[model samples]
Target chain A: MTAQALALPRAPRVDVRSVAFWVMIAASAYGLWTLKQNSVPTMLAFPPSAALNVAVLLSCLAVGVWLARRVMRPVQAPPWNGTWLALMWGGLAACGIAILMNTRLLSVWSQSLGLEAASDWSAALTAPLNEEVAKLAGVVLLAAVSTRLVRSAADGLAYGALVGFGFQITENFTYGLNGIVMAGGVEPFTATFQTLWIRIVLTGIGSHWAMSAVAGAGIGYLVSASGRSAARRVWVAIGCLLLAMGMHFLFDSPFLGGLAGTLAKPLINFVVVMAVYFVVRRAFRARWTAVSAEEAAAGTLTEDEERSLSRRRSRRLHLRAFPAGPEREAQARVQRLQLALVEERVPALAPAEAVQPWRDAVAEARAAR
Target chain B: MDDFKGNAVHGARRVWVPLVVAGVLLALTAVEGLLAKALPASEPVPAGTVIEFGSTGQVSAQVGEGWTLDRTASDLHSGLLLTRGDVSVRLTSVEFSAGKPDNAQEMWDGMERLLGVARHSGTEVWLGEPTEFDTKWITGGLYGSLQVDTAIGTAFVLPADDDAEAVEAQVLGPFDADQADWTAATEIIDSVAFDEDDDTGETA
Candidate 1:
């Protein structure tokens, strides 16, 4: 190991599960209290049917989970536990925090500042700042559970996206319900459906997930990124957090005034998404390079193996080059071996014994071929 | 040495990434500003003739020639009610004693039912639906439309020009009214304008 690698800080072995469990319980209690205090009366009147809200939430959950899995597939990240954590603590807990901020903190701060709740400044200034911070808390909570889970910028992004997915889906459901109430207490289904289409189908990608993922990359760099100098890590962290906030600000701002209702909305969404894509792609590639370099140093990876594993599509292509019968088995062996390599590398992950069988399977497949 | 090089490159990237992101955002904002400027300030009110309303004449409607102003039924703030043949365009703002309702259309519906406006002599025929209406100078994208008594006697209720506890309405006369009168009323509503520069100078 390089002196720099040995000098890198290790996170304390905290009991992440217990901490996460307590956080969830607190979030649930707070959520129930808020619901009783604010939502119950309106819900009784049935502006939008409860069933429709549940359907939207569940459907979004299913799609979000599926998307999280797909994104991790390319990276060969172990995602089930992290994905579950994101859905429960990130989704449900983060949502509770957001509601508390919106209902209580925002209102109190606005009043103190002598700003009316409906004022333009309140939305332009207070909303984006508070909401982004609240949502970022979800990523922080995820990291707290297990720093190893987010040991690189790429891992941070995937987990962050999942956290964002949870928050977005929950917030979308509320927005759908609110739209029903706004459209004059008639045809709840129509109003809610319209809201769902706009929040979910149209602006979903440009919304919470994209912004939070950028912030998560920053958190990832701070906690992980062993090679980076401390000052560089701080700069990256600050830059990413600010970028996330700025994206939210630009989206929420009425700078274009009435003209924004036209072609400007989609244009702005495209710009923000592209900016996030740039950061994400760079960070992801950097982490991959670091991992590959480590493998190279270990002398366990052949030149052919290294080339094949470099890209997801290329890796698949390399596996597929063998004949169909044993070729498929060999492909599976390669996948298992790669997964095992990742597990073996991470100290907090499964031990070397767990990966031995997968290595054996790869050797058997190579011999058969 | 490779690790050192990789770290140096990443460090450099970290410094430059924010600049790139900021530049992109600034460029997009500039484009938005330019596009907004290029678009016309507002579409001109359609009809050649205009009737000014409100104390400061902040609100105005472009009316067709044949319609006569109903001064007794009108005021500066409520707007000038116009009548031609049996058709009447009662330009009025419905103010709510309570703060703004969660849904303005539902509130209007309740008011109509309570006032028995649609149930004259117990013969009832009224239906409402979500619809779109545009005033030339001040366009509300979508609003509520209620057809009362006849196909032609419709009341379009929308969010007020600038008030939350109030709604703006343009009611047309029964279907029996002359075709020309109906056309004129619709035209006038479509061409309603608001001039924010002339704030009604009223102190609370």
Candidate 2:
């Protein structure tokens, strides 16, 4: 075979998976464009407040990148997978369900505890305990279905972070729309944007993701440990879940009277989250190194296979690193779908079927660019 | 292992960057506060300059070789007018007086007696309404009635002989306690012909 034939094709086959991926990208792009159009006038008038919002957004993006790097280590299965899609969509759905459940449960709990009539602190106390547990349930479900997917605490955290990000985006849109209606003009829109930036971006403190990752890591450990029973893993998961709930509770508590009080909680939460993140990162690095050494010793993966995998991964990363213009965005949409199919490990679908939707997405993305 | 350690260091650096930026912003705010103190204080309106008026009639006259009056109306039935250096004022629902008199209380009592009579019977008198009504008539802008008791009724009217003259007349009514008050009544008149001297003096 020629070198070109031997090499894996750069283009992805179009399919249902590609269609779904393209649709999501298109929806997200449209949503962002609409948001920008709505916000530009207000932001221009209130530059300082707008600057504050942008600062917060940039900070959140930085934190997100950091979380992705720290938690998405170890090449258990490639980063692109059907499970990722499911996790993103399922986690977002779970957050909605959780919020609903938490509201109902908290209402009852508060009434029972005579906290129904209380303001601020009482509500905060109830919310962190109830909502954090509910939001972490998706992470637990993921861990249960695919223990190998979460190789370390970092992996758990990464998965949780993605889920939390999805939830936050949805919640922000809700608040933004409500603000537009309530304020009925530019002033309200600016205020709403600031509020959204602070609540979602500043105080994120890895609440949903950190808590869920703790739970995910514990479950992963239980499943992977040769000596551990399934029952032990369940208990470990439960314990981690409870710990996360406590952290969330303390983070949300209103012990402080003013801005000082508000800053204190997020600061403390950040410290705790950082500590957990570092510990998990260390464990992931060690475990991956050990696994690589053993595999080399056993010769399960030859030097050639390892080199091939490395080259493949690098090519994928290179594709992502390309400048994000119209043509590049289209290519990315196609490539991501192909990767998703490969992750699914389904050989039945024709390559053309897999590649077609991606082509369409690329075309649309190109137009947008 | 070296690469791993380098990555970890990079991660630590990321955490400190935001903190440094925050510190810089705080320092800038402090500098702004210090600069604000160098600005000058604003001046207040000078004394004797009429910045505002109170709820009582006040007539300020600038009299040199000639006389000019700046009168302000206040309250119901209270107003001030001046002509030829003579200032007349009516107090709220009660008093009336003339001249740039210093004792307002004494002047008010004398005016009150005339007004009391005007109120009891149907007498021609100029009455001030709420602030929304026109004040030009009370400010010597137009002919109006200034009535005392039934025995002494003063009517402000244009003279039949001279269209330019604004004159007041005291008419005797049948309900007078004393008929002599009518003959003794003082009528203040102003004629537009007074402007001839002002015009001739300006030309000279």
Candidate 3:
């Protein structure tokens, strides 16, 4: 076997088009799990307002996904090397360390100055800036060690998102435990749950990941644009870092009304994001098509893949081809698995292979179409 | 092409971690829901009965097992006139008056003595004639009323008489024509008698 084959022995052969679909599902699932394990207990405390809390959480998640899609370009070819994992874990650790250090320092300073000790804004301001910078540092480290990990803006976003997810889970756990204490038993659990819903889920607003990804995107952009001067790259990184801080400030600032006001701001942000998305879509409309063509020409897409893509054009054909039959179901599942592989680019396929029956069913449906 | 190869590799690792994490979170949420459902209901506090203190000299009322004697500004002004559950009461309009006094000193001494005795007994007392004078005797006119109505009667210790004869009889002697025509008043006094000897001494 060739060295490339040896290096990527278990790597599945598929077009990059399928990869994005899988990565999104995996990321979404992880996000959902983290949200449930860390936030549900706190939400239960708000028994009376549990439904409202759940709604808020769902809305926030939707906003996060929408923002991710709009601001970050989709990575057609994902680099699944351990570099992404290291960046994710390292980013989380760095954020934790940064928070500890910044909080201690701020506490001492605020005390000496006769200011209120760090509670909401102080932590918000300090954490978003310091922790985001730290997480961005992981992206930088990954980019330095391996040029492949952050070949696109979307790659940076994915890594940053993972890091943010890690940070969010740890933070939510603390918030949940605090809620339990405040509730003082089951009677006030509803109130506790509501508090957690507002603080952890709704107010999250993707501040950490968005800010870190902004920095990561800058680094990726710098690395990709060849022959760029080091000074120019530094300037670009600094600009991105500043922009991230500004966004963090807007997110954390109390300028917005209290809980209701804060909640409203995210919606406003979403609207603004959507508008920007349309603009971006207009600009990149041709670019995506060109990229798709290039990918297809490079032998990345098989004849079956082309047929499957065509089948999705009509809803009737789409449904009929991707029918509920075990064979079609298996093909669909394989398609999903292959798509995930293409998106995440992770080499381990045992988990992916486990879902082959579903993939095969999906693929057969495509062939029928 | 090399970049594409790199991206393909990176994309694969991203899928599984999030999926596993999401599954765990869903399970946690379900557990939380179950725990919440299992929690017992909270105990409620019962509402207590209302206890009214009409005049408020010294209110010695039974609350549960204890007798509470509350010394507040007599319900005449802004004192505790009632106790209902967790709430207290205060009468807004009320006034008191003495029919006769030998002299100003006697009147002042009597008012002070009555107030002191009431205070000692844990009952609040106020001194002032039920007249059309908008002045407070205690706080140098900071607070008082001249109105003598049913609401005022409820606050004062004096008896109420609606009969013309009875009210006229009550405002005799010391309250006669020499001092003032009590009959000119719209509301007649129940009784306003002064001792002859006391009046004589005052005149002398």
Candidate 4:
């Protein structure tokens, strides 16, 4: 394994011609349609409660997507379209798949084990197996859609979180609708509001987003073009997925029954994600610094440029010394190209021509400076 | 740059990934659904017999003869669904984390929404107003009737055990169904009790 080989695909680029891209669209559309069939009528039936749930959930979705993008990656977040695509896959494709699979599987358990036993065990046994795979599949597809979308574990974590966030909000909205039934429908609006808050406040911390992010990191390992051994990558991927599923099972399981227990489940999941984030961030930073050092050795980047390139604010600070207008713009372009070159660089063993495009692009920018 | 075309290709296109993922997912769902369909999820429910269920065994209700309990659809935590040849009856109870509704009328309002008549599109149906009625063992229960083009039935909301706030039951069947069907439905509704210990509405 040449420790994770590859050039970063151009940022924010989707290989639209890829089979994966089309497959994602088709599956997501089908899922979205199925969900609408059940939800739309309920919305129309009780317009007020539905509207309230919609307003609240949509607000949460906006905040979640924004926050996930800002925090999931180390140096910078994954590009916008990829992040949106991951969320789309989560909300539409994964949720749809879970609905179909869980309904069937839960019935099987109920019939086979009888409702008495199935009640305690069915959800605990089912959702982790079904929903985690469904959500992780989205991350895998994004990688398949384009190498640029998820070049590292950091990329996978970010995209995975987005996907999970999408699934979480969609699930929350569904729960709000279901909440009416649970609360006996006496106070429809109140029931909806109560359900949304409990979910958003309590479980939302660790739920689908955290679990999928873990599983997605594993996919990052599996798909990484780096030097990690094939067996190692596969094992890490499997382990991460199982870990995610375990976390989910605990969340849905009957062991912890009350309010404190409810809070504990998500807290546990949040801690696990934070651990993975730190490790992935560290690895990404290490690789980044190593690449910059190599570029400096080759006289492609000056010491000051190398020091400031990886961080946005630092880059801005470095560029501040230059006068305004054309000079600043030229220097900014050179720095941008330099960072791109570092991101797209392959290992030393690869043929020299492999990095020629990015290197040439950087040189042109430098000349503009 | 040709081999490295499309924004600098790094990895071999794993085009087969999505196909395999989707195929496996569909395949699993199909297998599970088919297997569940092949096996029955119900047992015969006899008349004038007590049925004990729910998350714990505390919740109990009497059942009428000639119905099958759909264990798969029914849950110990929430309620039960039973079916006969053409008639289906469901006895559901929810213990609200918040207290019960303020009044039977509010509960009736809940039952109306629960019937979800408005959710079914392209249907012409009439739902009658609920009237307060006294049951054999329980008093002041509310009942309403609904007809969806052909099938007709009544829905009930009754005071439950102290632990549980209330219980709701609905019986739906064809119009020509015999009085025995109605007798069985009534038998179950009259004796619907949330807790076996309380036995507030125990019948002979």
Among these predictions, the greatest lDDT belongs to: 4
TM-score of each: 0.58, 0.42, 0.42, 0.91
CA shift of B174, model 4, Å: 0.8
Instruction: Calculate the i-RMS of every candidate, to one decimal place.
Output: 16.3, 29.5, 24.8, 4.0
Residue-wise lDDT of candidate 4 within A48-114, one digit each (tens)?
8899888987899889987887788876667777877898899998899889989988988888885
Docking level for model 3? incorrect
Model 2 ranges off by over 4 Å: A1-78, A82-91, A115-117, A144-148, A177-186, A229-232, A299-369, B1-204
TM-score for model 4? 0.91
Number of backbone collisions per candidate: 1, 14, 64, 11
Error of 4 at A32 (Å): 1.1
Segments of candidate 3 deviating more than 4 angstroms: A1-92, A111-121, A181-188, A225-236, A268-288, A294-369, B1-204
Chain B in candidate 3 has what TM-score? 0.19
Model 4: CA > 4 A from native: A1-12, A346-352, B1-13, B46-49, B52-58, B96-100, B116-120, B123-125, B161-164, B198-204
lDDT of 2 by residue, B1-204 (tens): 111111111233323432342244235334433432332111221222221111121221111222222221221112212222222222122111112223322222223333333343444444322111112222222223443433223333222122222122223334433433233222222221111223222210
Highest DockQ: give the candidate number. 4
Docking class of 2: incorrect
Positional deviation of A316 in candidate 3, in angstroms?
13
**Cα lDDT, all candidates:** 0.55, 0.39, 0.39, 0.78
Candidate 1 residue B77 C-alpha distance from true site, Å: 20
